[model samples]
Target: MTPESARALAEDYFNGGRPHPLDIGVYTFDAGYVAWPREPTPGDPTVLPDTVGGACIVIDRHTGEVSVRPLLPPELVAELWPDPTPR
Candidate 1:
């Protein structure tokens, strides 16, 4: 999923606006998620769907608080929250 579409979905369905789901295969990282719509195609279903996107906030595994944006670029993610270990 492209970052653009992910951002759009974040603004749209993050707060029960679209029944957003917050977990995925090997990537359960938050309290919100959006299942998204399936695309029409003629291929294997094992391949994960595209466009279905949402946001996840990285938190301290122990503290359980918002730490970083998670899965985002360092700069952008850092903007949301400071790096646990900075230079």
Candidate 2:
């Protein structure tokens, strides 16, 4: 899938049907996309306790399959893409 579409899917998967204060941000990667929650405004300092230890959402490039993985650096998550073991 294209990066734009992948990003949209990830955003929806991350935020859709959920009541969340923080917005979801997606990072593109060769393997797929990494999605994580972030403060809506930078340096807002609003405590998002729920975001602590939140899993990063990974979307497959080819299949658009979404998976939840432990929170990690985007590069590291991309490098370890397509992890077979479910979170």
Candidate 3:
């Protein structure tokens, strides 16, 4: 997703207006997809979505193309989330 679109989705769904990356949990950039945390921390007292998981924002870091929805599947998530080590 373009950074703006991802930021908007994060703002609308995750709360706190425009959120910093830390407001979510973990994130990864690979093959143009940004795996934004579906479970954003309740920084204040805003209601959160019932689904406790994550979503993928496909961002073309180079061209600025962006998209949301159709989050990454379980198998792909396994591939994305586990190996990064959060440096």
Which stretch of 10 consecutive residues in model 2 shows the poorest summed lDDT?
Answer: 42-51
- Which segments of model 3 are wrong by more than 4 Å? 1-22, 25-30, 40-49, 52-55, 73-87
Compute each candidate's TM-score over C-alphas.
0.26, 0.72, 0.36
* Best of the candidates, TM-score: 2
Clashing pairs in 2: none
Candidate 2: where is the Cα deviation over 4 Å? 18-21, 40-48, 84-87
lDDT of 2 by residue, 1-87 (tens): 888897677677667777763566788888788888774553556655534576888888888888888888877788777764534
lDDT of each: 0.39, 0.75, 0.48
Task: Supply candidate 2's per-residue lDDT for 79.
Answer: 76
**Stronger candidate by TM-score (2 vs 3):** 2
Best by lDDT: 2
Candidate 1 — which residues are off by over 4 angstroms? 1-17, 20-22, 25-55, 73-87
lDDT of 2: 0.75
User: What does each candidate score in C-alpha RMSD?
Assistant: 11.0, 3.5, 8.6
The CA-based lDDT of model 1 is what? 0.39
Q: Locate the minimum summed-lDDT window of 10 residues in model 3.
A: 78-87
